[model samples]
Target: MKKLALAVVVTMASSLCAMAASDVTKSPPPAPYEQVSKLVKLPDFLPGMGALFVDPATLPAGPFLAYDHGGKLVSTIYMLPIKDLNPDKRFDNLAAPGGNVDHVDVYYNAGHPGVPEPHVHVVLWHVPAADEARVAK
Candidate 1:
């Protein structure tokens, strides 16, 4: 059962990564941005999180895609609630949809409107450390 679940996750990640990569050059990022936003209610951009999108069906444990102002894919994020993290609860092999990750930043949030739970933002940055300045609004 565990193996089957893992396989499903891996397959979803691969599909998302391929879609994001291929559609990165599109006018408005139809795959990750337009398509995802149509499925979920997200703002155009978040100060520290960048342009964000998530599959609504995968809520709470989202492999959320973050893009820069110019519509460039920057990172993949997972909002893991503090209550959900324990020895018994393991989230392994989370995907980075933007291919190679340059760095990772994990931080705490005290609950926001979209995700109203005390959770940690597990950010997998695709751009170099310096290039992240693009999303610093």
Candidate 2:
């Protein structure tokens, strides 16, 4: 009877340990922005100033900036290619009739491995009316 009780206790303990280990490994990994935000400082020009978007479930990363003519945030720039960007192609298109885009900056993960894979930090800046130096400010 003593041996049987000991065997049952050991089996229960082993089963619990296996369950805990599986839980740890089955959980999704932490998001990249959570990791990057801790390391880098986003440029001051960034309007909404916050962590860039990066859904691990989705490949690539983005800190896209899409604002209205009045400087209101329209939406975040996703991973759409430059060629596919249309209708609102030029900086003037995004700004109010009179208001010009000073510059636009986007952050991404440069280390992105490839399609369906992970990446590192990547930043894309667009200055429709001015040069890089002018845009930096």
Candidate 3:
């Protein structure tokens, strides 16, 4: 009958629309895995007046390095996409040779050397082995 055919057509159209809508609402693919390189030493004059340095050899899709203003080698830092990280989490505590990290700063290159491609420079500070216990606490 005509009514039966109309009902069938409506059901088919609704189903198709539902399928299309579901596709649109589907979650996007997971972000690519970021490569992390080995910890490298920083140059004396990198930035902040010998306060920061990055080891060229340990670049992980980067040009990141460790930094220490006091020249004690306290912690290390690297460049990573801001979108790929948790804002509340500390990268040093997540990954680094020295567990005690003072802080981290993310900077976009402003005519600065060795930035833009790697997109990040990680600053790490050194914690004395003897002071590890005190620092940890």
- lDDT of candidates 1 onward, in order: 0.77, 0.36, 0.41
lDDT of 3 at 99: 47
TM-score to true structure, per model: 0.73, 0.22, 0.34
Worst-scoring 10-residue span by lDDT in model 1:
25-34
- Count the clashes in each prediction: 0, 13, 17
Say what the RMSD of model 2 is.
17.2
Q: Cα lDDT for residue 25, model 3?
A: 17
Give model 3's TM-score versus the native structure: 0.34
* Residue lDDT tens for model 3, 46-131: 44423333344443333332333333444445666544456674445345533445555456533233333434444444444443
Say which candidate scores most in lDDT: 1
- Per-residue lDDT tens digits for candidate 1, residues 9-72, read 9999999987766664323545434434455465578787787777666777788878888888
C-alpha RMSD for every candidate: 8.3, 17.2, 17.3
**Candidate achieving higher lDDT, 1 or 2:** 1
What's the candidate order when arranged by decreasing TM-score? 1, 3, 2
Model 3 score (lDDT): 0.41
Q: What digit string (tens of lDDT, one per residue) describes model 2 on residues 1-137? A: 99999999999999997664333111121233232222344432433332233334333324333333333333333453444346865332221211233444455433322222323222333334333333222
